[model samples]
Target: MDKKTENFLGIDVGGTHVKIGLVDTKGQILQFAKEITASLRENPLGFNLAFVEVVGKYLAKFPEVQHVGIGLPGLVSKDRTTTLEIPAISELNGFDLKSALLEKYPNTIFHLENDASAAAVGELHFGTGQTSQDYLFITLGTGIGSALILDGEVFKGVRGNAMEMGHMLSRGNSRLEPLIGRNGILKIAARMMDTFPEEVGQLAGQELGMHVLVGAASAGNSIALKTFAEVGEILGEAIVSTVRILDVNEIYFGGGISAALPYIMPSLDKTVHQYLSPYYLSDIKMQRATLENDAGTLGAAALCFMD
Candidate 1:
Protein backbone atom coordinates (compact mmCIF):
# COMPACT_ATOMS: atom_id res chain seq x y z
CA MET A 1 0.00 0.00 0.00
CA ASP A 2 1.15 3.50 -0.76
CA LYS A 3 2.20 5.59 2.23
CA LYS A 4 -0.66 8.01 1.57
CA THR A 5 -3.09 5.09 1.55
CA GLU A 6 -2.61 4.39 5.24
CA ASN A 7 -6.20 3.49 6.01
CA PHE A 8 -8.88 3.80 8.65
CA LEU A 9 -11.03 1.00 10.01
CA GLY A 10 -14.80 1.22 9.61
CA ILE A 11 -17.03 -1.24 11.38
CA ASP A 12 -20.77 -1.60 10.92
CA VAL A 13 -22.41 -3.29 13.90
CA GLY A 14 -25.86 -4.42 12.85
CA GLY A 15 -28.48 -6.48 14.69
CA THR A 16 -27.30 -9.79 13.24
CA HIS A 17 -23.62 -9.30 12.39
CA VAL A 18 -20.64 -7.02 12.37
CA LYS A 19 -18.80 -5.96 9.16
CA ILE A 20 -15.29 -4.62 9.32
CA GLY A 21 -13.16 -2.98 6.64
CA LEU A 22 -9.99 -1.10 5.88
CA VAL A 23 -10.85 1.96 3.79
CA ASP A 24 -8.71 4.72 2.35
CA THR A 25 -9.51 8.34 1.44
CA LYS A 26 -10.04 7.34 -2.19
CA GLY A 27 -13.05 5.18 -1.32
CA GLN A 28 -11.30 1.87 -1.75
CA ILE A 29 -11.92 -0.98 0.66
CA LEU A 30 -8.71 -2.90 0.94
CA GLN A 31 -9.85 -5.59 3.31
CA PHE A 32 -13.17 -6.69 4.76
CA ALA A 33 -14.37 -9.18 7.41
CA LYS A 34 -17.71 -10.13 8.85
CA GLU A 35 -18.67 -12.03 12.03
CA ILE A 36 -22.09 -13.45 12.78
CA THR A 37 -23.16 -13.44 16.40
CA ALA A 38 -26.30 -12.53 18.34
CA SER A 39 -24.50 -11.82 21.57
CA LEU A 40 -22.40 -9.07 19.99
CA ARG A 41 -25.37 -6.97 19.03
CA GLU A 42 -27.23 -6.93 22.35
CA ASN A 43 -24.93 -6.97 25.34
CA PRO A 44 -22.78 -3.84 25.60
CA LEU A 45 -19.97 -5.74 27.30
CA GLY A 46 -20.21 -8.58 24.86
CA PHE A 47 -20.35 -6.13 21.98
CA ASN A 48 -17.31 -4.27 23.25
CA LEU A 49 -15.25 -7.39 23.82
CA ALA A 50 -16.26 -8.80 20.46
CA PHE A 51 -15.35 -5.52 18.81
CA VAL A 52 -11.98 -5.41 20.48
CA GLU A 53 -11.17 -8.98 19.55
CA VAL A 54 -12.26 -8.70 15.94
CA VAL A 55 -10.89 -5.24 15.27
CA GLY A 56 -7.73 -5.79 17.19
CA LYS A 57 -6.95 -8.84 15.07
CA TYR A 58 -7.51 -6.90 11.84
CA LEU A 59 -5.60 -3.81 12.85
CA ALA A 60 -2.68 -5.78 14.12
CA LYS A 61 -1.68 -6.37 10.51
CA PHE A 62 -1.50 -2.63 9.87
CA PRO A 63 0.23 -1.19 12.89
CA GLU A 64 0.10 2.45 11.86
CA VAL A 65 -3.70 2.86 11.77
CA GLN A 66 -4.59 6.04 13.60
CA HIS A 67 -8.39 6.09 13.74
CA VAL A 68 -11.33 3.74 14.26
CA GLY A 69 -15.08 4.36 13.77
CA ILE A 70 -18.16 2.32 14.56
CA GLY A 71 -21.68 2.44 13.23
CA LEU A 72 -24.30 0.99 15.54
CA PRO A 73 -27.87 0.01 14.72
CA GLY A 74 -29.27 2.29 17.43
CA LEU A 75 -28.61 5.93 18.15
CA VAL A 76 -25.06 7.06 18.89
CA SER A 77 -25.15 10.02 21.22
CA LYS A 78 -24.36 13.44 19.76
CA ASP A 79 -21.57 13.97 22.23
CA ARG A 80 -19.82 10.80 20.89
CA THR A 81 -19.50 9.46 24.43
CA THR A 82 -22.46 7.11 24.60
CA THR A 83 -24.78 4.93 22.57
CA LEU A 84 -28.15 6.55 23.24
CA GLU A 85 -31.67 5.15 23.21
CA ILE A 86 -33.40 3.30 20.36
CA PRO A 87 -36.03 0.61 20.11
CA ALA A 88 -35.07 -3.09 19.63
CA ILE A 89 -31.53 -2.70 20.93
CA SER A 90 -32.79 -2.25 24.48
CA GLU A 91 -29.50 -3.30 26.09
CA LEU A 92 -27.51 -0.32 24.78
CA ASN A 93 -29.59 2.28 26.52
CA GLY A 94 -27.47 4.89 28.30
CA PHE A 95 -24.16 3.11 27.70
CA ASP A 96 -21.18 5.46 27.84
CA LEU A 97 -19.39 3.69 24.97
CA LYS A 98 -16.79 6.27 24.01
CA SER A 99 -15.33 6.35 27.47
CA ALA A 100 -15.20 2.58 27.53
CA LEU A 101 -13.47 2.26 24.18
CA LEU A 102 -11.04 5.05 24.94
CA GLU A 103 -10.08 3.44 28.18
CA LYS A 104 -9.38 0.18 26.39
CA TYR A 105 -7.37 1.64 23.50
CA PRO A 106 -5.75 4.87 24.57
CA ASN A 107 -3.72 5.48 21.45
CA THR A 108 -6.42 5.76 18.77
CA ILE A 109 -9.28 8.17 18.12
CA PHE A 110 -12.79 6.74 17.87
CA HIS A 111 -15.98 7.92 16.18
CA LEU A 112 -19.48 6.50 16.60
CA GLU A 113 -22.89 7.05 15.00
CA ASN A 114 -26.11 5.36 13.94
CA ASP A 115 -25.66 2.88 11.11
CA ALA A 116 -27.97 4.72 8.70
CA SER A 117 -26.29 8.04 9.33
CA ALA A 118 -22.92 6.41 8.76
CA ALA A 119 -24.16 4.89 5.48
CA ALA A 120 -25.47 8.28 4.40
CA VAL A 121 -22.08 9.82 4.92
CA GLY A 122 -20.42 6.89 3.17
CA GLU A 123 -22.72 7.48 0.19
CA LEU A 124 -22.01 11.20 0.39
CA HIS A 125 -18.28 10.57 0.20
CA PHE A 126 -18.02 7.68 -2.27
CA GLY A 127 -21.33 6.88 -3.93
CA THR A 128 -23.98 8.74 -5.97
CA GLY A 129 -24.75 10.73 -2.82
CA GLN A 130 -21.45 12.51 -3.35
CA THR A 131 -23.08 14.82 -5.87
CA SER A 132 -26.21 15.86 -4.03
CA GLN A 133 -26.55 18.74 -1.61
CA ASP A 134 -29.51 17.16 0.16
CA TYR A 135 -30.33 13.45 0.22
CA LEU A 136 -32.08 10.97 2.45
CA PHE A 137 -31.21 7.29 2.71
CA ILE A 138 -33.75 4.69 3.80
CA THR A 139 -32.51 1.14 4.33
CA LEU A 140 -35.27 -1.46 4.30
CA GLY A 141 -33.97 -4.33 6.38
CA THR A 142 -35.42 -6.32 9.33
CA GLY A 143 -36.38 -2.87 10.52
CA ILE A 144 -36.06 0.51 8.86
CA GLY A 145 -33.02 2.79 9.06
CA SER A 146 -32.94 6.31 7.64
CA ALA A 147 -30.45 9.15 7.33
CA LEU A 148 -30.54 12.73 6.12
CA ILE A 149 -27.96 14.98 4.51
CA LEU A 150 -28.22 18.75 4.19
CA ASP A 151 -25.75 21.11 2.57
CA GLY A 152 -23.42 18.16 1.97
CA GLU A 153 -23.30 17.10 5.59
CA VAL A 154 -24.98 14.24 7.42
CA PHE A 155 -27.84 15.64 9.57
CA LYS A 156 -27.71 14.14 13.05
CA GLY A 157 -30.87 15.27 14.81
CA VAL A 158 -30.81 16.89 18.21
CA ARG A 159 -30.60 13.60 20.09
CA GLY A 160 -28.42 11.94 17.45
CA ASN A 161 -31.49 9.92 16.48
CA ALA A 162 -33.09 11.88 13.70
CA MET A 163 -34.46 10.60 10.40
CA GLU A 164 -36.02 7.51 11.91
CA MET A 165 -38.76 7.32 9.30
CA GLY A 166 -39.33 3.61 9.88
CA HIS A 167 -40.89 4.10 13.27
CA MET A 168 -43.18 6.76 11.87
CA LEU A 169 -46.85 5.75 12.15
CA SER A 170 -48.37 4.66 8.87
CA ARG A 171 -52.00 3.57 9.39
CA GLY A 172 -52.47 4.71 12.98
CA ASN A 173 -52.21 0.98 13.58
CA SER A 174 -48.47 0.20 13.92
CA ARG A 175 -45.12 1.72 12.97
CA LEU A 176 -43.75 1.84 9.40
CA GLU A 177 -40.96 -0.59 10.31
CA PRO A 178 -43.42 -3.47 10.39
CA LEU A 179 -45.13 -2.24 7.25
CA ILE A 180 -42.22 -1.57 4.86
CA GLY A 181 -39.02 -2.50 6.62
CA ARG A 182 -37.47 -5.83 5.48
CA ASN A 183 -39.11 -8.06 8.03
CA GLY A 184 -42.17 -5.86 7.87
CA ILE A 185 -42.63 -6.86 4.24
CA LEU A 186 -42.41 -10.51 5.25
CA LYS A 187 -45.01 -10.02 7.94
CA ILE A 188 -47.34 -8.44 5.42
CA ALA A 189 -46.67 -11.26 3.00
CA ALA A 190 -47.17 -13.94 5.62
CA ARG A 191 -50.43 -12.38 6.70
CA MET A 192 -51.60 -12.14 3.13
CA MET A 193 -50.48 -15.69 2.42
CA ASP A 194 -52.27 -16.98 5.49
CA THR A 195 -55.43 -14.91 5.08
CA PHE A 196 -55.92 -14.93 1.34
CA PRO A 197 -53.99 -18.17 0.60
CA GLU A 198 -53.85 -17.71 -3.18
CA GLU A 199 -52.53 -14.18 -3.48
CA VAL A 200 -49.02 -13.20 -4.68
CA GLY A 201 -48.07 -12.29 -1.11
CA GLN A 202 -47.35 -16.01 -0.67
CA LEU A 203 -44.15 -15.58 -2.59
CA ALA A 204 -40.97 -15.85 -0.53
CA GLY A 205 -38.44 -13.29 0.85
CA GLN A 206 -38.10 -10.26 -1.43
CA GLU A 207 -41.15 -11.54 -3.26
CA LEU A 208 -43.55 -10.23 -0.61
CA GLY A 209 -46.29 -7.59 -0.73
CA MET A 210 -44.23 -4.77 -2.19
CA HIS A 211 -42.67 -6.90 -4.90
CA VAL A 212 -45.99 -8.57 -5.61
CA LEU A 213 -47.67 -5.20 -5.84
CA VAL A 214 -45.01 -4.05 -8.29
CA GLY A 215 -45.31 -7.24 -10.29
CA ALA A 216 -49.03 -6.61 -10.44
CA ALA A 217 -48.42 -3.10 -11.71
CA SER A 218 -46.17 -4.58 -14.37
CA ALA A 219 -48.88 -7.07 -15.34
CA GLY A 220 -51.75 -4.58 -14.88
CA ASN A 221 -53.27 -6.14 -11.78
CA SER A 222 -55.69 -3.66 -10.23
CA ILE A 223 -55.64 -5.20 -6.74
CA ALA A 224 -51.86 -5.28 -6.83
CA LEU A 225 -51.94 -1.68 -7.91
CA LYS A 226 -54.08 -0.90 -4.91
CA THR A 227 -51.62 -2.52 -2.58
CA PHE A 228 -48.78 -0.40 -3.89
CA ALA A 229 -51.09 2.57 -3.86
CA GLU A 230 -51.61 2.09 -0.15
CA VAL A 231 -47.90 1.66 0.62
CA GLY A 232 -46.84 4.41 -1.76
CA GLU A 233 -49.48 6.66 -0.34
CA ILE A 234 -48.04 6.16 3.12
CA LEU A 235 -44.47 6.58 1.88
CA GLY A 236 -45.42 9.55 -0.23
CA GLU A 237 -47.14 11.21 2.65
CA ALA A 238 -44.01 10.68 4.69
CA ILE A 239 -41.70 11.94 1.96
CA VAL A 240 -43.86 14.99 1.38
CA SER A 241 -43.86 15.60 5.08
CA THR A 242 -40.10 15.33 5.06
CA VAL A 243 -39.80 17.70 2.13
CA ARG A 244 -41.89 20.33 3.84
CA ILE A 245 -39.74 20.08 6.91
CA LEU A 246 -36.30 19.71 5.31
CA ASP A 247 -36.88 20.96 1.75
CA VAL A 248 -34.53 18.23 0.47
CA ASN A 249 -35.10 17.41 -3.18
CA GLU A 250 -33.07 14.30 -3.88
CA ILE A 251 -33.67 11.14 -1.91
CA TYR A 252 -31.72 7.89 -2.29
CA PHE A 253 -32.96 4.53 -1.02
CA GLY A 254 -31.31 1.11 -0.80
CA GLY A 255 -31.41 -1.99 1.39
CA GLY A 256 -32.17 -5.67 1.12
CA ILE A 257 -35.79 -4.93 0.23
CA SER A 258 -35.33 -1.91 -2.01
CA ALA A 259 -35.60 -4.47 -4.78
CA ALA A 260 -39.32 -3.83 -4.36
CA LEU A 261 -38.84 -0.37 -5.77
CA PRO A 262 -40.44 -1.55 -8.98
CA TYR A 263 -43.64 -1.94 -6.98
CA ILE A 264 -43.17 0.88 -4.48
CA MET A 265 -42.01 3.78 -6.69
CA PRO A 266 -45.17 4.32 -8.70
CA SER A 267 -47.33 4.56 -5.61
CA LEU A 268 -44.65 6.54 -3.85
CA ASP A 269 -44.54 9.06 -6.68
CA LYS A 270 -48.30 9.13 -6.97
CA THR A 271 -48.69 9.85 -3.29
CA VAL A 272 -46.04 12.53 -3.38
CA HIS A 273 -47.71 14.12 -6.40
CA GLN A 274 -51.26 13.91 -5.16
CA TYR A 275 -50.86 15.12 -1.59
CA LEU A 276 -47.73 17.23 -1.30
CA SER A 277 -47.93 20.89 -2.16
CA PRO A 278 -47.14 21.08 -5.89
CA TYR A 279 -44.25 23.36 -5.07
CA TYR A 280 -42.62 20.70 -2.98
CA LEU A 281 -42.87 17.81 -5.44
CA SER A 282 -42.08 19.77 -8.58
CA ASP A 283 -38.32 19.37 -8.49
CA ILE A 284 -37.81 16.45 -6.14
CA LYS A 285 -36.25 13.31 -7.54
CA MET A 286 -36.32 9.86 -6.00
CA GLN A 287 -33.49 7.49 -6.78
CA ARG A 288 -32.48 4.07 -5.48
CA ALA A 289 -29.86 3.99 -2.73
CA THR A 290 -26.57 3.16 -4.43
CA LEU A 291 -24.33 1.37 -1.95
CA GLU A 292 -26.57 -1.20 -0.31
CA ASN A 293 -24.71 -3.06 2.49
CA ASP A 294 -21.42 -1.37 1.78
CA ALA A 295 -22.75 2.08 2.61
CA GLY A 296 -22.66 1.56 6.34
CA THR A 297 -19.08 0.40 6.49
CA LEU A 298 -17.86 3.13 4.19
CA GLY A 299 -19.88 5.70 6.08
CA ALA A 300 -18.45 4.55 9.38
CA ALA A 301 -15.02 4.77 7.78
CA ALA A 302 -15.76 8.33 6.71
CA LEU A 303 -15.78 9.34 10.33
CA CYS A 304 -12.07 8.75 10.33
CA PHE A 305 -11.51 11.64 7.93
CA MET A 306 -14.64 13.77 8.26
CA ASP A 307 -13.85 15.54 11.51
Candidate 2:
Protein backbone atom coordinates (compact mmCIF):
# COMPACT_ATOMS: atom_id res chain seq x y z
CA MET A 1 0.00 0.00 0.00
CA ASP A 2 1.21 3.48 -0.78
CA LYS A 3 2.19 5.37 2.40
CA LYS A 4 0.42 8.50 1.26
CA THR A 5 -2.86 6.73 0.58
CA GLU A 6 -2.96 4.47 3.63
CA ASN A 7 -5.36 5.16 6.46
CA PHE A 8 -4.76 4.35 10.14
CA LEU A 9 -6.78 4.03 13.30
CA GLY A 10 -5.96 6.00 16.46
CA ILE A 11 -7.45 5.23 19.85
CA ASP A 12 -7.25 7.50 22.88
CA VAL A 13 -8.08 5.53 26.02
CA GLY A 14 -9.62 7.38 28.94
CA GLY A 15 -11.26 6.29 32.17
CA THR A 16 -14.74 7.14 30.89
CA HIS A 17 -14.46 6.65 27.12
CA VAL A 18 -12.18 5.57 24.33
CA LYS A 19 -11.96 7.88 21.33
CA ILE A 20 -11.24 6.25 17.99
CA GLY A 21 -10.31 8.09 14.83
CA LEU A 22 -9.82 6.83 11.31
CA VAL A 23 -7.17 9.10 9.93
CA ASP A 24 -5.36 9.59 6.68
CA THR A 25 -1.63 10.19 6.36
CA LYS A 26 -2.18 13.94 6.27
CA GLY A 27 -3.40 13.94 9.90
CA GLN A 28 -7.05 14.29 8.92
CA ILE A 29 -9.59 12.28 10.86
CA LEU A 30 -11.85 10.74 8.26
CA GLN A 31 -14.17 9.08 10.75
CA PHE A 32 -14.40 9.28 14.54
CA ALA A 33 -16.18 7.21 17.18
CA LYS A 34 -16.25 6.59 20.92
CA GLU A 35 -16.46 3.53 23.19
CA ILE A 36 -17.73 3.94 26.70
CA THR A 37 -15.18 2.62 29.19
CA ALA A 38 -17.85 1.42 31.55
CA SER A 39 -19.45 -0.63 28.80
CA LEU A 40 -16.14 -2.31 28.03
CA ARG A 41 -15.72 -3.27 31.68
CA GLU A 42 -19.02 -5.12 31.55
CA ASN A 43 -17.63 -7.71 29.12
CA PRO A 44 -17.16 -11.15 30.65
CA LEU A 45 -13.76 -11.52 28.97
CA GLY A 46 -12.49 -8.65 31.17
CA PHE A 47 -11.47 -5.11 30.26
CA ASN A 48 -8.22 -6.08 28.57
CA LEU A 49 -9.86 -8.53 26.17
CA ALA A 50 -12.77 -6.21 25.66
CA PHE A 51 -10.35 -3.45 24.66
CA VAL A 52 -8.60 -5.77 22.21
CA GLU A 53 -12.02 -6.52 20.77
CA VAL A 54 -12.47 -2.79 20.21
CA VAL A 55 -9.74 -2.79 17.54
CA GLY A 56 -11.50 -5.58 15.70
CA LYS A 57 -14.79 -3.76 16.09
CA TYR A 58 -13.32 -0.82 14.20
CA LEU A 59 -11.33 -2.90 11.73
CA ALA A 60 -14.51 -4.63 10.65
CA LYS A 61 -15.98 -1.19 10.11
CA PHE A 62 -12.92 0.09 8.23
CA PRO A 63 -11.11 -2.92 6.76
CA GLU A 64 -8.53 -0.87 4.91
CA VAL A 65 -6.79 0.35 8.05
CA GLN A 66 -3.73 -1.79 8.74
CA HIS A 67 -2.08 0.28 11.48
CA VAL A 68 -3.63 1.16 14.85
CA GLY A 69 -2.25 3.41 17.57
CA ILE A 70 -3.33 3.81 21.17
CA GLY A 71 -2.56 6.59 23.63
CA LEU A 72 -2.77 5.38 27.22
CA PRO A 73 -3.28 7.62 30.25
CA GLY A 74 -0.54 6.04 32.36
CA LEU A 75 2.79 4.25 32.33
CA VAL A 76 3.71 1.79 29.56
CA SER A 77 6.62 -0.63 29.70
CA LYS A 78 9.98 0.08 28.10
CA ASP A 79 9.14 -2.46 25.41
CA ARG A 80 5.77 -0.74 24.92
CA THR A 81 3.94 -4.04 25.22
CA THR A 82 2.25 -3.71 28.62
CA THR A 83 0.55 -1.05 30.71
CA LEU A 84 1.68 -0.33 34.27
CA GLU A 85 0.24 1.64 37.14
CA ILE A 86 -2.82 2.77 35.21
CA PRO A 87 -4.79 4.54 37.95
CA ALA A 88 -8.05 4.86 36.05
CA ILE A 89 -8.08 1.42 34.41
CA SER A 90 -6.75 -0.95 37.01
CA GLU A 91 -7.66 -3.99 34.91
CA LEU A 92 -5.10 -2.98 32.28
CA ASN A 93 -2.27 -2.81 34.77
CA GLY A 94 0.47 -5.27 33.81
CA PHE A 95 -1.66 -6.49 30.89
CA ASP A 96 0.18 -7.42 27.70
CA LEU A 97 -2.02 -5.38 25.40
CA LYS A 98 0.26 -5.70 22.36
CA SER A 99 0.16 -9.48 22.39
CA ALA A 100 -3.60 -9.45 22.70
CA LEU A 101 -3.92 -7.10 19.76
CA LEU A 102 -1.62 -9.24 17.67
CA GLU A 103 -3.39 -12.49 18.54
CA LYS A 104 -6.70 -10.94 17.54
CA TYR A 105 -5.46 -9.18 14.43
CA PRO A 106 -2.29 -10.93 13.27
CA ASN A 107 -1.78 -8.79 10.18
CA THR A 108 -2.24 -5.33 11.67
CA ILE A 109 0.41 -3.04 13.23
CA PHE A 110 -0.17 -1.35 16.56
CA HIS A 111 1.58 1.47 18.44
CA LEU A 112 1.11 2.43 22.08
CA GLU A 113 2.36 5.44 24.02
CA ASN A 114 1.68 7.60 27.02
CA ASP A 115 -1.23 9.95 26.22
CA ALA A 116 0.87 13.05 26.93
CA SER A 117 3.62 11.80 24.60
CA ALA A 118 0.99 11.08 21.98
CA ALA A 119 -0.30 14.64 22.33
CA ALA A 120 3.21 15.95 21.86
CA VAL A 121 3.52 13.85 18.71
CA GLY A 122 0.15 15.18 17.59
CA GLU A 123 1.37 18.73 18.06
CA LEU A 124 4.50 17.86 16.15
CA HIS A 125 2.49 16.66 13.17
CA PHE A 126 -0.76 18.63 13.27
CA GLY A 127 -0.45 21.61 15.60
CA THR A 128 -1.18 25.14 14.32
CA GLY A 129 1.88 26.56 16.18
CA GLN A 130 4.29 24.05 14.59
CA THR A 131 6.34 23.07 17.64
CA SER A 132 10.09 22.74 17.31
CA GLN A 133 11.90 19.44 16.95
CA ASP A 134 12.85 19.59 20.62
CA TYR A 135 10.47 20.92 23.29
CA LEU A 136 8.63 20.05 26.46
CA PHE A 137 4.88 19.33 26.24
CA ILE A 138 2.67 19.66 29.31
CA THR A 139 -1.04 18.99 29.70
CA LEU A 140 -2.95 20.73 32.53
CA GLY A 141 -6.25 19.08 33.34
CA THR A 142 -7.40 16.69 36.06
CA GLY A 143 -3.72 15.98 36.61
CA ILE A 144 -0.49 17.42 35.30
CA GLY A 145 0.82 15.16 32.53
CA SER A 146 4.05 15.80 30.63
CA ALA A 147 6.19 14.43 27.78
CA LEU A 148 9.52 15.35 26.25
CA ILE A 149 9.89 15.58 22.46
CA LEU A 150 13.55 15.53 21.59
CA ASP A 151 14.87 15.33 18.03
CA GLY A 152 11.28 14.92 16.80
CA GLU A 153 10.54 11.82 18.89
CA VAL A 154 9.20 10.95 22.34
CA PHE A 155 12.06 10.73 24.85
CA LYS A 156 11.53 7.60 26.84
CA GLY A 157 14.04 7.57 29.67
CA VAL A 158 16.07 4.52 30.71
CA ARG A 159 12.86 2.79 31.75
CA GLY A 160 10.43 4.26 29.13
CA ASN A 161 8.71 6.61 31.61
CA ALA A 162 11.05 9.59 31.83
CA MET A 163 8.97 12.72 32.12
CA GLU A 164 6.65 12.26 35.05
CA MET A 165 6.47 15.93 35.93
CA GLY A 166 3.25 15.59 37.89
CA HIS A 167 5.10 13.50 40.45
CA MET A 168 7.80 16.13 40.87
CA LEU A 169 8.04 17.96 44.20
CA SER A 170 6.87 21.52 44.67
CA ARG A 171 6.05 23.83 47.62
CA GLY A 172 5.69 22.00 50.97
CA ASN A 173 7.30 19.05 49.17
CA SER A 174 3.88 18.17 47.68
CA ARG A 175 3.61 16.57 44.27
CA LEU A 176 3.27 19.01 41.38
CA GLU A 177 -0.05 17.59 40.18
CA PRO A 178 -1.70 17.75 43.60
CA LEU A 179 -0.68 21.40 43.75
CA ILE A 180 -1.97 22.50 40.31
CA GLY A 181 -4.32 19.82 39.09
CA ARG A 182 -8.09 20.34 38.89
CA ASN A 183 -8.87 19.52 42.50
CA GLY A 184 -5.78 21.34 43.68
CA ILE A 185 -6.71 24.48 41.75
CA LEU A 186 -10.15 24.41 43.33
CA LYS A 187 -8.61 24.13 46.76
CA ILE A 188 -6.45 27.16 46.03
CA ALA A 189 -9.51 29.10 44.88
CA ALA A 190 -11.31 28.22 48.06
CA ARG A 191 -8.41 29.38 50.19
CA MET A 192 -8.12 32.66 48.26
CA MET A 193 -11.88 33.30 48.49
CA ASP A 194 -11.87 32.62 52.22
CA THR A 195 -8.93 34.92 52.77
CA PHE A 196 -10.54 37.78 50.87
CA PRO A 197 -14.28 37.22 51.17
CA GLU A 198 -15.05 40.68 49.74
CA GLU A 199 -13.84 39.67 46.23
CA VAL A 200 -16.18 36.70 46.06
CA GLY A 201 -19.10 38.05 43.98
CA GLN A 202 -20.79 35.53 41.70
CA LEU A 203 -18.69 32.82 43.28
CA ALA A 204 -20.00 33.52 46.78
CA GLY A 205 -22.54 30.72 46.87
CA GLN A 206 -21.96 28.74 43.68
CA GLU A 207 -20.16 25.41 43.67
CA LEU A 208 -16.51 25.91 42.90
CA GLY A 209 -15.41 24.29 39.62
CA MET A 210 -13.02 24.93 36.76
CA HIS A 211 -15.78 26.34 34.54
CA VAL A 212 -16.86 28.77 37.24
CA LEU A 213 -13.24 29.71 37.93
CA VAL A 214 -12.46 30.36 34.27
CA GLY A 215 -15.68 32.31 33.84
CA ALA A 216 -14.92 34.42 36.84
CA ALA A 217 -11.43 35.10 35.54
CA SER A 218 -12.79 36.11 32.16
CA ALA A 219 -15.12 38.54 33.88
CA GLY A 220 -12.10 40.20 35.58
CA ASN A 221 -12.81 38.76 38.99
CA SER A 222 -9.91 39.45 41.31
CA ILE A 223 -10.15 36.24 43.26
CA ALA A 224 -10.22 34.02 40.19
CA LEU A 225 -7.23 35.78 38.66
CA LYS A 226 -5.33 35.50 41.91
CA THR A 227 -6.12 31.79 42.16
CA PHE A 228 -4.77 31.13 38.69
CA ALA A 229 -1.77 33.36 39.39
CA GLU A 230 -0.75 31.28 42.37
CA VAL A 231 -1.30 28.09 40.45
CA GLY A 232 0.94 29.52 37.72
CA GLU A 233 3.69 30.34 40.17
CA ILE A 234 3.77 26.83 41.53
CA LEU A 235 3.69 25.33 38.04
CA GLY A 236 6.36 27.78 36.96
CA GLU A 237 8.70 26.65 39.70
CA ALA A 238 8.42 23.07 38.50
CA ILE A 239 9.02 24.19 34.91
CA VAL A 240 12.13 26.04 35.96
CA SER A 241 13.66 22.81 37.18
CA THR A 242 12.37 20.80 34.19
CA VAL A 243 13.64 23.35 31.66
CA ARG A 244 17.06 23.38 33.28
CA ILE A 245 17.24 19.60 33.19
CA LEU A 246 15.98 19.28 29.62
CA ASP A 247 17.49 22.49 28.20
CA VAL A 248 14.64 22.92 25.76
CA ASN A 249 13.79 26.24 24.13
CA GLU A 250 10.06 25.80 23.55
CA ILE A 251 7.10 24.59 25.60
CA TYR A 252 3.46 23.93 24.78
CA PHE A 253 0.50 23.73 27.18
CA GLY A 254 -2.60 21.64 26.46
CA GLY A 255 -5.65 20.19 28.27
CA GLY A 256 -8.83 21.85 29.68
CA ILE A 257 -7.32 24.07 32.38
CA SER A 258 -5.05 25.63 29.77
CA ALA A 259 -8.03 27.74 28.72
CA ALA A 260 -7.25 29.92 31.71
CA LEU A 261 -3.60 30.23 30.58
CA PRO A 262 -3.99 33.93 29.99
CA TYR A 263 -4.79 34.40 33.65
CA ILE A 264 -1.89 32.18 34.69
CA MET A 265 0.74 33.53 32.30
CA PRO A 266 1.59 36.63 34.29
CA SER A 267 2.77 34.79 37.37
CA LEU A 268 4.06 31.78 35.44
CA ASP A 269 6.28 33.95 33.26
CA LYS A 270 7.51 35.88 36.25
CA THR A 271 8.44 32.78 38.18
CA VAL A 272 10.26 31.14 35.27
CA HIS A 273 12.20 34.27 34.31
CA GLN A 274 13.18 34.95 37.89
CA TYR A 275 14.74 31.50 38.27
CA LEU A 276 16.24 30.74 34.86
CA SER A 277 19.50 32.17 33.54
CA PRO A 278 19.76 34.15 30.30
CA TYR A 279 21.17 31.11 28.49
CA TYR A 280 18.04 29.04 29.00
CA LEU A 281 15.75 32.04 28.49
CA SER A 282 17.09 33.23 25.16
CA ASP A 283 14.58 31.50 22.83
CA ILE A 284 11.97 30.13 25.21
CA LYS A 285 8.41 29.91 23.87
CA MET A 286 5.48 29.11 26.10
CA GLN A 287 1.97 29.13 24.66
CA ARG A 288 -1.33 27.25 24.58
CA ALA A 289 -1.55 24.29 22.24
CA THR A 290 -3.73 24.79 19.16
CA LEU A 291 -5.19 21.26 18.80
CA GLU A 292 -7.74 22.00 21.56
CA ASN A 293 -10.49 19.34 22.05
CA ASP A 294 -9.28 17.14 19.21
CA ALA A 295 -5.83 16.71 20.76
CA GLY A 296 -6.48 13.25 22.16
CA THR A 297 -7.92 11.65 19.03
CA LEU A 298 -5.53 13.44 16.71
CA GLY A 299 -2.66 12.62 19.04
CA ALA A 300 -3.50 8.92 18.99
CA ALA A 301 -3.56 9.09 15.21
CA ALA A 302 -0.21 10.85 15.22
CA LEU A 303 1.32 7.75 16.79
CA CYS A 304 0.87 5.91 13.52
CA PHE A 305 3.34 8.36 12.05
CA MET A 306 5.93 8.10 14.80
CA ASP A 307 7.94 5.32 13.22
Task: Point to the candidate with the largest lDDT.
Answer: 2
Query: Using Cα atoms with residue i matched to residue i, what is each candidate's TM-score against the true structure?
Result: 0.84, 0.98
CA RMSD per model (angstroms): 3.7, 1.0
Q: Candidate 1 lDDT, tens digit per residue, 1-307?
A: 3335668888887766778888887668888888875766644656656656666776677677778878888876777778777455555678887777777778878888888888788877778544575787777666778888877666877765689888777777688877766555545545554665555442434444444645655775544545555566667777877778788778887776666676778879887888777677777888777777588788888777666
Give the alpha-carbon lDDT of every model.
Answer: 0.72, 0.92
Residue pairs with backbone atoms closer than 3 Å in model 1 (clashes): 214-263, 253-289
Window of ten residues with lowest summed lDDT in model 2: 1-10
Off by over 4 Å in 2: none
Off by over 4 Å in 1: 1-4, 39-45, 86-89, 190-229
Most accurate candidate by TM-score: 2
In each prediction, how many residue pairs overlap at the backbone (N, C-alpha, C within less than 3 A)? 2, 0
Q: Model 2, 144-246: lDDT tens per residue? A: 9999999999999899999999999999999999999999999999999999999998898999999999999999999999999999899999999999888
